[model samples]
Target: MTEATVGEFTTRASSINRALDQIGDKWCLLIIQEVLWGINSFNEMMAAMGVSRGVLSNRLKWLQEVGCLRREEGVAGSHRPRYHLTSKSIALYDCAMMAITWERDWYQTPALDRVELVHLPCAKPFVAQLRCACCDALVCLRDVSYQPGPGATRDVREKKVRRRSSIAITEVRSEHALYRNLINVVGDRWTSNLIALSFHGLTRFEQFHQELPVATNILSDRLKLLVEEGVLEQVVYQQRPLRYEYHLTEKGQGLFPWFLTLLQWGDTWCDPQGRGKPMQVTHNPCGEQLQAQVHCSECHGVLKAHEVRFTLDGEDMNP
Candidate 1:
């Protein structure tokens, strides 16, 4: 019950939501990866990215301000600032590694980007479940359980965690093997662009293509793949000639937290990449500009990831 040291993670648990918010972005994780891999100087990071100087600077500043990095003086060089990872940032390496693994397996197309990943001790890829923990079935987050882990320390006075009886979880499964599955079914495409058009209500076929001037075949393939995975369902709103629109199912929309996770990560660790500007959402009745905060089902208290517990007995439990 002592306080966690620099190398250890807390077992009591706190803000799982905030932890998710931090490393969940495509850029933040990648930037952090580069920084951890000895790209400590500004010029080094810029060279690694090949992006705009402004973009690189902004991401570095955001990560530093959020306490992931510290700007200390150079040891004996020309007196320039260097970035070093905080203890918290170092702990996040595992999560970032996982996300990168998913990207390589699921989203990758070229041999250059399709690098393999593995965990440290096991030195193996995907030795864990790809499905949601809440509902043991093969599904994404929408109807899934997302309680905190053991090492949490949430703001109990401001938000209380509640118990969950039989939490809702979505089930999913795909027969694909030896690949990084699509961990980000909703937002983010560092190598590509998505969601910005969708958020602007661009559901039509032409609008999506026009907004993102990528190859038509690529977009078509992505769309078809998403539909097949049940992330985006093509619903026919009009019946006369059968007009269809892509709408997010529960599994897709369940990623709103992941969406907020990415947005906040971008805000803190990446530049406002034209698309990465502010997106303020509000509760309709309360008018409160809402950030993504999880609440308990029973008491409606704001939840930390670990305070609640789930039982295995349910209608959709996986064997």
Candidate 2:
């Protein structure tokens, strides 16, 4: 593997990066999703996720090592082992919902369309929505501001990082995934990092390069992919020598909820040093700290893991 500098000079520590380091891989996220949906056995996960035996085994071990999953003995007389989500992994439920919401909004995901989400508290079908806990107001990317938090530190990144995977998400063979498009975008560590940096108002290529410290070619390829995916649009900023600035499109802005939920999850579960938080976000409209909450669109009630159920083909699949 070739070496890539994550950061040459000091850069602010980010919970998002830490979280990505653990679960940002394409297979890793998909495996976690499968386990969350009750597909925990090795063979079950392999068939459901369309992942190879070796890759699946590696990711399963990695997940266990990272505290996202735990290996448990199967039922009495069974020889196979099973995987289960830990509290840390379960906390990612909000991110998953936001991802589903974004995917349904952007693409015609038949699998997602067939699956129905029901909020048990309200006893009604609903869509997921993000709201600020401070005032119960809908949270938008435009209305959020952030600054360094107590956990913020100048991080000197590792000099050697793995090269990005060559395989594209669309090329992966998955038959039962709800957030395929979302995965296609953020499944890669660097791609997700770019999206996170964009939320911090980064635009220019040089700006992203400085913050990410990825190889120039890899960074360029990711940017082009984002543009092709319609998440980012390039605007001509200079005519001489042809310079441009990247700006998020409407579709990209729609991902704010997902990223916000992920950031909160990272802050809670990925902080190894117990540093408070890497960044503090404030709701501009409410003038209070932003505390994100996922709620049901139909009832406006907060969503809890045990308080949600899924229905597929008129069959209740409660988790």
lDDT of 2: 0.85
Overlapping backbone residue pairs in candidate 1 total: 18
Which tens-of-lDDT digit does each residue in 19-96 have in candidate 1? 433443334555665665557777766666444476567667868777888888878866778888886576453343
The TM-score values for the models, in the order shown, are 0.43, 0.93
Candidate 2 per-residue lDDT over residues 297-316, each given as its tens digit: 99899999888988887787
After best superposition, candidate 1 residue 62: deviation in angstroms?
Answer: 1.9
For model 2, where is the 10-residue window of minimal lDDT?
1-10
Segments of candidate 2 deviating more than 4 angstroms: 1-10, 156-167, 171-175
Give the number of the best model, judged by lDDT: 2
TM-score of 1: 0.43
Q: How close is candidate 2 to the true structure, as a TM-score?
A: 0.93
| Model 1 residue 179 lDDT score | 21
